[model samples]
Each structure stands twice: as structure tokens, then as C-alpha cells.
Target chain A: MESHSGIAAVVKKTLNRRYRAERRFRRIGLAAVAVGLLFLAVLFTAIVSKGYTAFQQTHVLLDVYVDPDVVHVGNLDSADYQGLIKASLRELFPDVKGHRDKRNLYKLVSSGAGSILRQKVLEDTSLIGRRIQIWVPADDDVDMVIKGHVDRSLPESQRRLNNKSLAWVDALKEQGRLEKRWNLTFFTAGDSREPELAGIWGATVGSFYTLLITLSLSFPLGTAAAVYLEEFAPRNRWTDLLEVNINNLAAVPSIVFGLLGLAVFLNFFGLPRSSPLVGGLVLTLMTLPTIIIAGRAALQSVPPSIRDAALAVGASKMQAVFHHVLPLALPGMLTGTIIGMARALGETAPLLMVGMVAFIVDIPRGFTDAATALPVQIFLWADSPERAFVEKTSAAIMVLLGFLILMNGAAVFLRNRYERRW
Target chain B: MTTVGEIRAANPRMTCRQVNVYYGDKHAIKNVSIDIGRNEVLAMIGPSGCGKSTFLRCLNRMNDTIEGCRVTGTITLDGQDIYDPDLDVVLLRAQVGMVFQKPNPFPKSIYDNIAYGPKIHGLARTRSELDQIVETSLQKAGLWDEVKDRLKHPGTGLSGGQQQRLCIARAIAVSPEVILMDEPCSALDPIATARIEDLIHELREQYTIVIVTHSMQQAARVSQRTAFFHMGDLIEVGPTDRIFTRPRHSLTEDYITGRFG
Candidate 1:
């Protein structure tokens, strides 16, 4: 009786120890999840806080004379409208007669101020020989003062904007001539040296064109390849090798796809460099293996009985696959395609190799036009020395992330809306 | 005992001659000769893995779908060799439909499930004609009254018995000459099993029915003729009543008297 009691006591002790270990494992899992969520929250907060200001820009409104003699109506695109802009600033503060002070005052407005007048003159020749009130962009240094980024208590030599230019910003504000509007130009223009004029329209358009080509080429080809391999391909050594290689290709580094594109598409095919067409062809190759794998999995998940029913009804193999299996597999296939697109959207290295890293001011008019995608645009801006570009880089990242979230949301919505349970 | 090679029906719809089957060098069925008569219920009964279901599938060549599965010898439908290389398997399957051990309905509306076969066969041209076929198929399977109000509901939502009947209705919609049931009631409750048994009795009047079942009682209840198989060999076959009451082979007698199976 004493030995039996001792064995029972030991069993009880071991059970309690196992229970305690189980509790510790649960707590560890909870901690791991908490750490993951905390990282995501910190990243989202940092990016939003650093980039949200890019949506607003400061502008100085001035009354200027669009004198035809200064603009030269015949050659409006090349005219030095910079002189007229400096003259307008001088007129605003006529008391600053010294050349060095006048130069410091001229620094308050953006260097693109001349290009803005040049665009306006070309847009409407009627503006020539007439005086009109125009909103010229405030310079990056002046913009920081207006947005409260510059500390006024600092010594003049310690800051980027001199005391004279900083005082001019306050004077303009007091005169109700300097104001920050919703930066519409940021969405309307393309890449520019001036941060206020830089917009994502070119990159966004390029992304759409590239995605169109990639999706169009990959989806049909991937589905066909998947259907053949999963359904019709004979069980042979050659087909098995192809299947193994296709799966391995999905795990290959995306940059290798870029190198392949450079070697074959640019050198052999002679496709235009930096065009959405070339970028799209490269992305298609990168995304095909993923789409094909997903397509085959989706096809396999459809019950064998469904195929039997179709066959029992006298439907041909192709007929049953296209009619029943393909529809049932659609939701999974679409989810995979969207994920592939999201990965393609953030790909910058391959696009860089194909010359999408070049500074392009004009928006791409077609698929063949030279273009830079969003991530490449971010890559370029992030490497620049300008302080305002820091904000632009983060904002472009936010835009790219927004598109990814939208694509993921669409995937979930499709799965829920069309999901069929058996 | 008609000399082992001459187990034939008077009005045979499908005839098998020295049929053997293999799954990658593992012989699954030996030389078996049998005949499935037209417009009658023929039941093949055996213990598990006795090649009963394998023999039934040979009629429609459904085993062709399995990888590494090969069939030799001749199986004929009507008076033609179905194993001929030029014979269309699609058409053969349409002529001989199948019902599985478990009810398998397409994930579609009740109306669509019945209409699937008809649409593929082009048996109906106008919308009303298609609706008529769906209604008649459902009515013929005795499911129309229960599901008439919810034709648009998915077929998978039906009860076990109803889904099996739906599969039966779907098969008949293609107007097949023979219907093969591979233990159609094995997955159902006793009550559901009885309903499917009654459905088999009703369907045997128009279609040649071949069923493989483990339960001797089910075979005795529904089949006009029964063939008993043991260890991939056909042990005895006769009229259903005679096979149960007076088995000619000791193996069949052992199986029937519960001595050994």
C-alpha cells in the first residue's frame, strides 16, 4: 500500500509539471504575437508621421507682369522667366536695395518658379502682355520656416535660410501673401528637382501599364501551363523534371529575373530601355511561376468527384476542366495573382537594371514610353541629398503600400464573396 | 456451372470475357466473365477488395482515370467492343453513368445540377425544355416534391438520401442506357439506405442497373440476379433468391451461412 501510494504521488507531480509547461508555451506564443504586432504598429506610425506633410506645400502669391518682351512669345519654352520672377520679388520688397540682400530675398521662392511661368505662358499665350496674380512655389528653405520646421531662436549662421530670407517669409505671411494649400501639384506633376513639383502620377501610370502587361501575359499562360501539367501531362521523366524546375523557379531571387531581362530583352530583343513594356515583360517572368503553382493547387483542391460527375455526363476532359474545375478554382487563382502583383509592385532592383532609375520629368504617354515605377522613384529620391526629398521618399513608400493593401483587400473580398464551401 | 466462361444473361446489355485488371504489376482482378442484362438489376456482392467494384467500373472504363491502372481482355456494350482504341470514352461514359459510394453532387443549384448533364449533351434547346428535363428528372427520382420550392438552392444542402437521389436524377438526365452504383448506400443510414434501395427498384425498369454491395441483404432486397465474388474470383452467380437459398459453390455457401467470407 505504501509503494502504490508513492507511485500515484509521482504521477500527480508529473501531471502538474506538464500542465505548467503547457501554460508557459501559451504565454510564449502570446508574447511572440505581441512582438509582431508591435513592430507593425511602429512602422505604420513612423511612415505616416514622416510623410503626411508632403501632402501640403507653401506658396507665395505675387502680382507679376507677363511682359512679351521678357518672355519672347516666339520661344516661350526657352525664355529665362527667372528674371521676371526675381523682379516681382524685388518689387514686393523695394526697400532692399543692396544686391546681396536682394539676392537673399529672391531665394524665398522656388527655382521652379521660372518653369511655372514658362508653363503658364505656353498654356495660355493670352497671359502675355497682361499682369496677373500667380501662386509661385515657396523655396524648400522658406517652406520649412512657413511649416515651423526651422527654429527662429537659432543664430542666423546656424540655419540654411539666412536671416534676411527668414524675415522675408514672416513679412510675406504678415501681408497674407504666403499660405499652405493642399498640394494638388504633388499629384498632378511628375518627377522634378523641386520637391513641391514632384508627383507620383508618372510612376502610378507606369505601374498600371506594367501590371497590365504582366497580368495579361502571365495569367493565361500560367493557367494553360497549370492545366496541362496537372491534368493532361503524361507521367514521364521529362514532365517531372519540368514540374520540379517550375517550383524551384518560384523560389528564385527576383533580381535574377531582372538580370535575365537585361540580357535577353534589352540586348537580344532590342526593346526600348526603361519602357513599361520591358518592365512588364520582366515582371511576367517573375510572376509566372507563382501564378502557375497557385493555379495547380486550386485545380487540385476541387474534389475528384466533381470531375467524375462531369465525365459521367459525357463531358470531354477539356470541357469539364474549363467548365467546372476552372470556376471552382478561380478564387484561389485570383488570390495568388494579386499576391504576385503586390510583389511585383515593390520590385525596384530589376526595374533599375532596365533603366527605370533615370530621372523622367514627363509622364509616360503609352506602354512604350520611358517610365519609372513607384519603388524606383522612391529609390532615386531616397538617395538624393536634399532634405525635402526625405519626405517625398516616405510619401512614395506610403503610396506603394496603399496599393498593396488595396490589392490584398481585393483578394480577401474576392475569396469571401465568391467562396464556395462543400 | 456453365464452364466458368459462359456466365451470360439472356438479353445482355454489357458482356465481359476473360477480363483481367492490373494496377502496376499488382493484379487486382483475374479472368472474370459475366453479363449485365438490359433493364434489370444485377448485383455483384463480395467482401472488401474482392474486385467487385473493379469489375463494375470496367463496364464504363472509369478505371481508365487511375494512373498505372491497365485493363486487358474484352468488355462489350451492346454488340461493340468498348476497349477499341477508336471508341470515344466520353460517349461510353454517357451511355453508362455512375453513382458513387458517397453521394457526390456538384456545388451548384439543384436545378443546375440536374441540368448539367442535359446541357452538356445538348438534350434541351430552349429554356423551357431544359426546365422540363430538370423537373422530370427530379420527379422521376422522387425528389421534386421536397425540393420543388427551392430549385435555386445548392444541391449540397440536401440531406444524405436526397443528395444520393439527386445524383441518380443527374445520371438519368443524360439518358444513359446503364447505371452503375458502387455501393451507393454504404454511407447512408438504414432509413436512407432503404430509400435508395427503393429508388434502384424504380430505376431498373428503364435502365440496366449494375450494383456492387457488401451487404448480402441489400443485394437480395433489390437485385433480380446476384453474382458472388471471393478473393478477386467469381464464386457463384444465379437468381437472387436461388443464390441466397441454395448456393452451388462451397465458398458461396460459406459466405451465405456466415461460416466464412
Candidate 2:
């Protein structure tokens, strides 16, 4: 009796220790998950705070008197457009003088401002003789001063924009000439070497073109591969080998796909460099394994009895797959495809190898044109030494994240709208 | 329950001789032979994995879908060799339609589910004709009144028994000569099972039904003839009444009397 009681006490202690260990393990797991979520929150918050400022831009409204002699209709392209904006700024602040002060005054407007002045005269030829009011984008350094990003108390040697540039920005601000406007041009215009004139239009359009080709190529080919492999293929050592190879293909590093594209698509095929078509072709290879694997899983998840029911109703094998099985599996396939495409959208390395990392200034008009995708745009911006490019990079990240969210939301909606429980 | 000497109905619609099924190296069904009479309810009662469901799938060549599953020997329907290479499996399935163990209605509307088979087979030439086929099929399955107003609603929203009946209605919409039911009531409650049994009785007047069942009482109640299968072999087959009252085979008698399966 005494031994039995002792044994019971020992068992109870051991069980208590086991329970404590279990609790500790559970808590550790929960803490790990919490840490993961915390990192994501921190990352997103950091990107958003840095990027939000880029969405609004500073502009300087100028009333430049365009003398016809300065820019005749015949020589409109060769106008001293920068001198016109400089003269306007000089008139606004007549107290400033000398070559140094005059150069500082010209720095107030965007380097692209001269180009804008020329565009204004060319658009309405009558403006060449008239006093035209126009809004010109401010230079990035001067614009930073107006937006309170520049420290005025800092030594002139330590600052990117000196007191001379700050003085002109202050003059514009006092006269209600400098205003912050929603940056529509960022969405409409193409890439530029000047920070203020650079926009996401080129990269966004390139993304669209690449994705168009990626989706068009991957969906049908992936679905067909999945159906044939799952439904029709005979089981043998060779098929088993094929299955293993397919899974391995999915796990292969994406950069390797880029290299393959570099060799086969660009070098061997002699396709156009920096084309969305080649970028898409590379991404298609990277995306196919994901789609095919997910599509097969989607096809597998559908109960075999559904196929049997269709077959029992006299549906041909093709009819059974197309009419019954495909519809049932479509939601899963669509979600997988979207996720794969979203991953492709954020992929930079494969696109980089296919020469999609070029400084493309024009929005890709077609699949065969030179273009830079969004992630490559972010990469390029992040590499730039300019202070404004920091905001541009983060803003590009925000856009990329937004697109991913949209794709996931679309996936969820498709799944919910068409999914059947049974 | 007892099994008398083997019995044969007057007009056999399907005749199977030495049918064998193999799933890889596993011999799933041995040489099993049976006759399914025209427009009569034939019940196959067995314990699980006795190949009754497999044999039912054989009727429409539905076994062809399973990977590594091989079927050998002859199965004829209405004096036609169904395994003929030139024979269209699609047309054969239209004639020998099947109901699954679990009710599987398509993700489509009730009207569309019923219309699918007819539309695929080109049985309906016009809109009204297609509507008429759906109506009569639902009526024949005894689900018309309950679902008449909700024909456009998804078939999955129906109750369990209603869904099974909807599946039945879908099969009949194809105008099949034979309908194979593989444990159609195993998944249903007693009340639903009883409703399905009643449906089978009424359907026997028009289409031939071969139901694989696990319930002895269900077999006794619905089937005109019962075939007992054990370990991949047909042990006994006879009139359902005689099979219950005077089973000749010891194993058959043991299985039906609740001694042991």
C-alpha cells in the first residue's frame, strides 16, 4: 500500500513536469509567431511613413512673358526656355544679383521646367506672344526645402541645398507661388534622370505588359499539363520520374530561370533587349511549375465521384473535364494562378537577367518594347544616391504591395463566389 | 435470413460472365457472374470491399477512371458487348447511368444539373423541350413538387434526401436504360433512406436498378432479387424473400441472421 502511494506521487510529479514542458513549448511557439507578425508590421510601417510624402509634390507657378523674338514658331524647339523661367524668378526677386545668385535662382524650378516651357509654347503657338501662367515642378533640392525636409539651421557646406537656394524657396512661398499639388504627373509621366520628373508610369505599364504575357502563357499551359498528368497519364516509373522532376523544377532558384532566359531567350532567340515579351517568357517558366503544381492539387481536391457522375451521365472524357471538373476546380486554380502571378510581379532577379533593369524612359507601348518593371524600378531607385529617390523607392514598394493585396483580394473573391462545399 | 437455390428473372437486360477486377497487384474482384433483369431492382449485399460497388462501376465502364485499375472479361447490356473497342463509352454511359454512394449534384442550378445530360446528348432540340425533360425527370424522381419553384437555385442547397433524389433526377434526365446505385442509402438517415427506398420501388417500373447495399433489411425491403457477395465472390443469389427466409449457403445464412458477416 505504501509503495503504491509512492508510485502514484512520482507519476503525478512526472505528469506535472510534462504539463509544464507542454505549456512552455506552446508559449514559445506563440512567441515565435508574434515575432514574425511584429517584423511584418514594422516593415510595412516604415515603408508607408517614408513613402507617403512622395505622393504630393511641390510646384512653382510662374508667369513668364514669352517674347516672340525669344522663341519664334520656326525655332520654337531651340527656345531659351530655362532663361525665360530664370528671368521670371529674377524679376520676382530683383534684389538678388551676380552670376552665383542668378544660378541659385534658376535652381528653384525643376531642370525639366525648361522642357515644360517649350511644351507650353508648342502646344498653343499663340502662347509664344502672350503672358502665360504655368505651374512648373520645383527642383528636388529646392522642393525638399519647401516641404520642411531640409534643415535650414545646418551649415551651408553640410546641406545639399545652400542658403541661396533656401532664400529663393522662401521668396516663392511668401508670394503664394509655391504650392503642394497631388502628384498626378508621377502616375502619368515616364522615368526621368531628374528626381522630380521621374514617375512610375513606365514601370507600371511595363508590369502590365509583362503580366499580360505571363498570364496568357501560364494559365492554359499549366491547366492543360495538370489535367493530362492527373487524369490521363499512365502510372509508371517514367511518369514517376516526370513527377519528381516537375516538383524539383518548382523549387529551382528563380535566378536560374533568369540565366536560362539570358541564354536561350535573349542570346539564342535574338529577341529584343529589355522587352516585356522576353521578361514575361522568363517569368512564365518560373511561374509554370507553381501553377501546374497548384492546379494539380486543385484538380485532386475535387472528389472523384464528381467526375464519375459526369461520366455516368454520358459525358465524354473531354466533356467531363471541361464541363464538370474544370468548373469545380476553377476557383482553386484561379487562386493559385493569382498567387503565382503576384509572386512573379514582385520578382526582380529573373526580370533583371532579361535586361528589364534598363533605364527605360518611355512607357512600353507594346510587349516588344523596352521597359522596366516595378520591382526593378524600386531596385534602381534604392541604388540611387539622391535623397528623393528614397521616397520614390518606398512609394514604389507601396504600389507593389497594393497590387499584391489587390491580387489576393481578387483570389479570395473568386474562391468565395464560385466555390462549392461538396 | 436464408438463401434458396439461385433464381433467374424472365428478361435479363445485362449479363456478366467471369468479370474480374484488379487494382494493381491486388485482385479486388474474382470471377463474379450475375444477371440484372430488365426494369427490376437487383440488390447486391455485402460487407465492405466485396467489390459490389466495383462491379456496379463496371456496368458503365466508370472503373476506367481509376488509376492502375484493370478490368477483364465480358459484360453485356441489351445484347451489346459493352467492352468493344469501337463502342463509344459516352453513349454506353448514357444508357447505363449510375448513382453514387454519396449524393453528388453539380455546383450548378437544379434546372441546369438536370438539363446537362440532355443538352450534352443533344436530346433536347429547343428551350421548351429541354424544360420539359427537366420537369419530367424531376417528377419521375419524386422531387418535382418540393423543388418546382426553386429550379434555378443551386442543387447543393437541397436536403440530403432531396439532393440524392436530385441526383436520381439528373440520371433519369439522360433517359438511361439501367441505373446503378452503389450504396445510395448508406450515407442517409433512416427517414431519408426509407424515402429513397420508396423511390427505388417506383423507379423499378421504368428503369432497371442495381443497388449495392450494406443493410440486410434495406435489401429485403427494396430488392426483388438479392445477390450476396463475400471476399470478392458471389456467394448466393435468389429471390429476396427466399434469400431472407431459407438461405441455403451457410455463410449467407450467417451474414443475414446477424451472426457474423
Candidate 3:
């Protein structure tokens, strides 16, 4: 009894220390989670704050008389729409008179404003002689000034906008002619040398085609490989070697797939360079290992009893797997396929080696058309020498993140929908 | 050495001669032979790892599913060699079905669980025929009244006893000549065990059964003839009453009298 009491005292003495250690471990776990959340919060705030303004563009409202003499040139394509825009700006600020000042005055309007007027005249020939009020996009510098990105209080040498140009913008604001509208061009048009005229549509379309091919090619190939390896392949040295290679392939740098694509697809097979077809082929090779690994894991997770039940009922081995095992494993396979596709969507290095890094200005019309993926577009914009491209880069990053979230959400949705209790 | 008790039946349905089972390099089941009679329940009882379940699996070639498990012997159903390579295993399994120790229902509705075997084997010509087979199979298993209202519900949602009955019903839906049950009531409670034991009694009128059980009392209760296995060898086979009371083998007597299993 005395020895038992002594043991009890020892236990009682250590109890509080054990509880304290438990609490300390819990506190450390909470701190780790808190730190992760803080980093995520910082990233999201930085992207959103810089990119939100890119969704709205600055526009200057102008009343321009489409002089028939200037617009009705014999060749309508040769019409001087820029002259009409210049004449309209001169009409708005009649006091600005000299050549250099007039040039600064014309700089307040985007060069694409001429193309907009030309499209208007082409759509309605009668508009050639009438004075119509229209909102036209302002120059990127004027846009930066209006969005508070450029400091107007700085000296002329230190700012993108001169004091005179800032004065014209202030005059336009006073007349309520300056407005920020939804930047539809960012969604509807293609990339351009001029940042104001650029949009992400080209990159978005390229990404869609690339992923479509990647999904179609990799999913079937990966799932078939996984099923054969897991279910039918004899466990021998060759199969073990194959399994090891598959795992090793998954860890290989993605750029090696790009190099392979360059040598085999571009040089030997002679597929079109800088096309979604080639990019999709390259990405398929990159994602196949990931998909196969995931498919195998999913197939393995299915309880062996289901197979036995099916087999005992006289179902063939193939029939049993296709009818019961595949259906159960499908949700998992789809999740893996989507994850691999998401990675392929964000992939850029391989595409670059395949010539997808070319300056593709047209929205990809077909799989073989020259194209640039969203990440590559971001990379290109980020590398540009224009200050306006900074916001565009962040905006592209936001779009990429949105696509990633959408793909992951789809994975969760499919998993929940098809998941069954065994 | 020969088995100590009668090894031949007056009307044998399946006959085994000198069967041996090997797992990798281990001799799991030594040369043992027995006859399974028509429409009779044969119970195999033994201590753990004595090759009773292994011997039972070999009856329907379920041992083929396991890696490195090899069986060699001439086993015949109705005087035809079942081990003939030309004999389709799928067709053989349809002729002889199995129910496992643990209840394993497909992740499907109750109606579909019974219909799956008949449907896959093309036993039904129309939807109505399939539905009829499902109802009759469930009725025969004595689960129709409890689950008739929830035919569309998942079979896995049933209780443990109900699920085991469902698996038995699934095996019966194939219209097999023989049903091999591997400890069909071990996972169940006493009441469910009694219910299954009664079902086995009634089923013996139509289908030949071979059951492997751990409980000697279960063997005595449900079986006509009992075979006792010990250490990879079959020590005795005789009428259950004679084997429990007037045993020929000392090992069988020792196992039955609660001395040492």
C-alpha cells in the first residue's frame, strides 16, 4: 500500500507538466496555422489592391464633327480618322494653339480612339457629317494620372504626365467628361504593343484549348496505365522498374518535358510551333505521371471485398472492375485528372520551348493556331518596359488564381457527387 | 496416412482425392480427401490456421484469387474434372457460389444487390422478370418483409445480420447447385446465428452446402456430417452425432471435449 501511494504521488507530480506540454503543443499548432493564414492574406491583399483598378479604364468624352471631307476619302480605308480626333480635341480646347502643345493635347486621347471612330463611320455611313458625342479611352499616361497611380504634384521630369497634360485632364474632369467605365477591351480583344489596347482574351482562349487536349490525352492514357499496372501486370522486376520510373518522372522538372517537346514534336514530328496542339501534347507528357499516380491511389483505396463480391457472383475480372471498381474509383480519378490539368494550365516553361512564347496577338481560333497561355502572358507583360503593364501583370495573376480555385472546386464537387459508402 | 473415419458418401455430389494446398513455400493443407453429399450440409471445424478455410476455398477455386496460392488434386463435381483448364472459371463460379464470413454488400440498392447476379448471367429476359427474381430471392432469404419497403435504399445501410442475409441471398440468386459458406454467422450475434442456422437447415433441401465453422457446437447444430482438421491434416470425418459422442480419432475427441483445440 505504501509503494502504491508513492507511485500515485509520482503520477500526480507529473500530471500538470504533461497537461502543460499538451497545451504548449496545441498553441504551437495554432501559431503555425495563424502564420500560414497571415501569408495568404498578405498575398491576396497585394494582388487585389494593385489589380482592381485594371478592371476600370479612364475615358474622355468628346463631341466630334465627322467632317465629310476628311472621312469620305475615295478609299475609305485611307481615311484620316486620327485627323478627325485631333480636330475634335482642338475644338474642345480652342485656347491650346502651338504645335508641341497641340501634340500634348492630342496625347490626352488614346491612339485607338481613331480606330474607334473609323469603326463607327464604317457601321453607319450617315455619321460622316453629323456631330456625335462618344466616350473614348484616354491614353495610358492619362489613365494612370486619373487612377492616382501617377503623382500629379510631382515635377514634370519626375512624372509620366507633364503639367500641361495634367491641366487638360483636370479641365476634362471639371466638365464631367472624364469617367471610368468597365474595361470591356480587357475581356474582348487581343494583346497589343500598347498596354491600353491589350486584353487577356487571347491567353484565356489558348489556355482553354491547351487544357482540352491535355485532358483528353492524359486522362485516358493515365487511367489505362494505372489500371493495367495495379490490376493485371505481373509483379516482376520489369514492372517494379516501370513503377519506379513513373514515380521518378513525376518529380522531374517540367522544363525537361519542354525540351523533349522541342526535339521530338517541333523538330522531328514537325508539328506547328507555338500552337496549342504542341503545347497540349507537351503538357500531356508532363501531367501523365501525376494522373497515373493519383489514379492508382484511388483504385487501391477501393476495398478488396467489393472485387470478391463481384467475382463470387460469376462476373468476369474485366466486368467486375469496369462495373464496380471503376465506378467507385472514378471520382478519385477525376479529382486527380483535374489537379493534373490545373498544373498544366499554369505551366509555361514547356510551352516556351515549343515556341508558345512567341508574341501571339490573335485569339487562338483552333488547336493548331499560334497562342500564348495566361501565365506566359503574365510573364511577358511583367517583363515589358511599360509602367502600365505592372497592373496588367497583377490582374493576370488574379485571373490565374481564379482558374486554379475553379478547378479545385470542380474536383471537390465531383468527389462529393460520386463518392459512395461501401 | 488415411483419414480415421468414413470418407465416402452414399450419394456424393463432389468428390476430392488427395488434395494438397501450398502457399508460396508453406504446405498449408496436406493430402486430404472427403466427399460432399448431395443436398447435405457438411461442416468443417478446426482450430485457427488449421487449413479448414483454405480447404473450403479450394472447393470452388476461390484460392485462385490469392497470390502464390496453389492447389493440386483431382476434384470432380458430378464425376467431371473441375480442374480442367478448358472449364471456364466464371461458369464454374455461377454453378457453385460462395458467401463470406464478413457481410459484404455492393454499394448499391437492396433490389439491385439481389438482381446483379441474375442480370449479369442473363437469367432474366425482361425488367419484370428481373424484378420478380429480386423479390423471390429476398423472400427466400427471409428478408423480404423487413426490406421490401426500402428496396431502393443502399444495401450497406442494413444491419450486420441483414447484410449477411443479403450476401446469402445474392449467392442464391445465381441458382447455383452448391453454396460454399465461410463462417457465415461468426460475425453475427446469437439470435442472428440461430436465424442463419435455421435458414441453412431449410436450404439443405435444395442446395448442397459446405460450411467452415470455428464453433464445434455450431457444427453439431447445423451439420449432418462433420470433418475435423488439425495442423494441415484432416483427422476425422463421420456423422456429426457419432463424431461428437463416439469419436475414432483422439484429436477429434480432444477438440470436442474441451481439452485442447
* DockQ (model 2, Cα): 0.78
The residue ranges of model 1 lying beyond 4 angstroms of the native Cα positions read A1-15, A66-81, A115-132, A148-158, B1-6, B257-261
- List model 1 lDDT by residue over A345-409, tens digit each: 88898898888888999999999999999999999999987778887888888999999999999
Q: How far does residue A135 in candidate 3 sit from its true spot (Å)?
A: 0.9
| Off by more than 4 A, model 3 | A1-4, A73-78
Clashing pairs in 1: none
Best model per DockQ: 3
Please report, in order, the local distance difference test score of every candidate based on alpha carbons. 0.88, 0.90, 0.91
DockQ each:
0.77, 0.78, 0.82
Candidate 3 interface RMSD to the true structure:
0.7
**TM-score of chain B alone in model 1:** 0.96
**Candidate 2 residue pairs that clash:** B2-B243, B2-B244, B2-B246, B2-B247, B3-B247, B3-B248
Worst 10 residues of 1 chain A by lDDT: A141-150
Residue-level lDDT tens digits of model 2 in B28-50: 87887778899889999888888
Candidate 2: regions farther than 4 A off? A1-30, A93-101, A130-133, A151-155, A171-176, B1-4, B7-9
Tell me how candidate 1 scores on lDDT: 0.88
